[model samples]
Target: MKILIIEDEIALQQSIAESLEKENFLVETAADYHSAVEKVFVYQYDCILLDIMLPKGSGLDILEELKKVGKAENVIIISAKDSLDDKLKGLELGADDYLTKPFHLAELNARVKAVLRRKNQQGKNTIELRNTVLDLNERQFFVNDKNIPLNRKEFDILNYFLLNKKRLVTKTGLAEHVWGDNSDQADNLDFVYYQIKNLRKKLQEAQAEIEIESTYGIGYKLIEK
Candidate 1:
């Protein structure tokens, strides 16, 4: 899943991003309200970890703006404020969960997973499609009950396609989602092609009925027969 963290604490933000990245999530950050607003407006995220207290503006405003745009992006408020009023107001403004400051990173990670599970996985950890089964926690794929080994990039590529199944995903979108900021300096998308090819080969070898369609000059689509 893709996540946007709107926190003014640089150290904490970096820590959160790193932790989520290690968990195979596409993560981005915004230190203030304007950047957060811009990100939420332009890009789509499965969830947002927003700090109630920011430098330029309150994170509550960002939540309000998301609601105004009719964007149903799941939001979790993270702040030092432990007041019941703040929690109630944030929940009223559509926050999914609240995390107070000085909390454990592991606890924060758990909360994020809980919110995403409710939002996308319907509270399940495994994602099953066609003959393929993906273990979200283990980051493993199985076909016909046989485990398939996949490199990190290949696994992430497959996960991305599964997440957006039957949708046209551009090369740019794939790069951004998988490689993130580093993709900006990439001159060619041959790496993406290579990774997709590897993933497709593995799925085919396993007799999985899923296929990825290359959209010529565009991108790819995961099609399941």
Candidate 2:
């Protein structure tokens, strides 16, 4: 999963980013409001860790902007304030959960997982479509109950495909989600093409009931056989 951390405290932001990265999530950060707004406008994330307090603006405003634009990333409000109003206001603006400062990173991770489960995975740890299963926690994939081992990028791409099954996945969106947004600096996405080709070959060899269909010069979609 991809996560965006909107925080101004340098140490805390770095700590949270490092923790999520260790958890094998693609992590991105913005210390202030404008950059955070820009990111939400451009990219989609599985979840967003938002701080109530931000430089040049408040995180609540950011939530409002996201709603206005129809961005549905699960949001977890992280703040030092313990006020009920602040919590209520955030929830009203579409936050999935709130965490006060001086809390454990483990707890934060648990909350993130819970929100992702409830919203994205329908409260399940495994995603199943036809005969294929993608295990979120174990980072495993199975075809007809047989293990289909995958490297990190391949797994990420497959996960995204299953999550969006049958929906057109643009190349830019795929690159940004599986690779970091910074990957756009590369000269080409030949790397992405190679990865998809390799993964598709594996699925076919396994006789899996799913196929990744490509739209020439556009994108790809996951379809069941």
By lDDT, the best candidate is 2
Each model's C-alpha lDDT? 0.81, 0.84
Give the per-residue lDDT digits (tens) of candidate 2, residues 1-225: 999999999999999999889879999999999999999889889999999889999999999888887764599988874455777788888887777776667557756765676585556889888899999899999999999999999998998787667767767667755774355577988888999999999999999999999999978989999
| lDDT of each residue in 63-179, candidate 1, tens digit only | 887888876457888876345577678888888777666666655665676567557666677778988998879999999889999998888788777766776777866775577
Per-candidate TM equals 0.54, 0.54
The local lDDT score (0 to 100) that residue 161 gets in candidate 1 is 76
- In candidate 1, how many Å is residue 91 off? 19
The residue ranges of model 2 lying beyond 4 angstroms of the native Cα positions read: 1-56, 60-73, 76-120
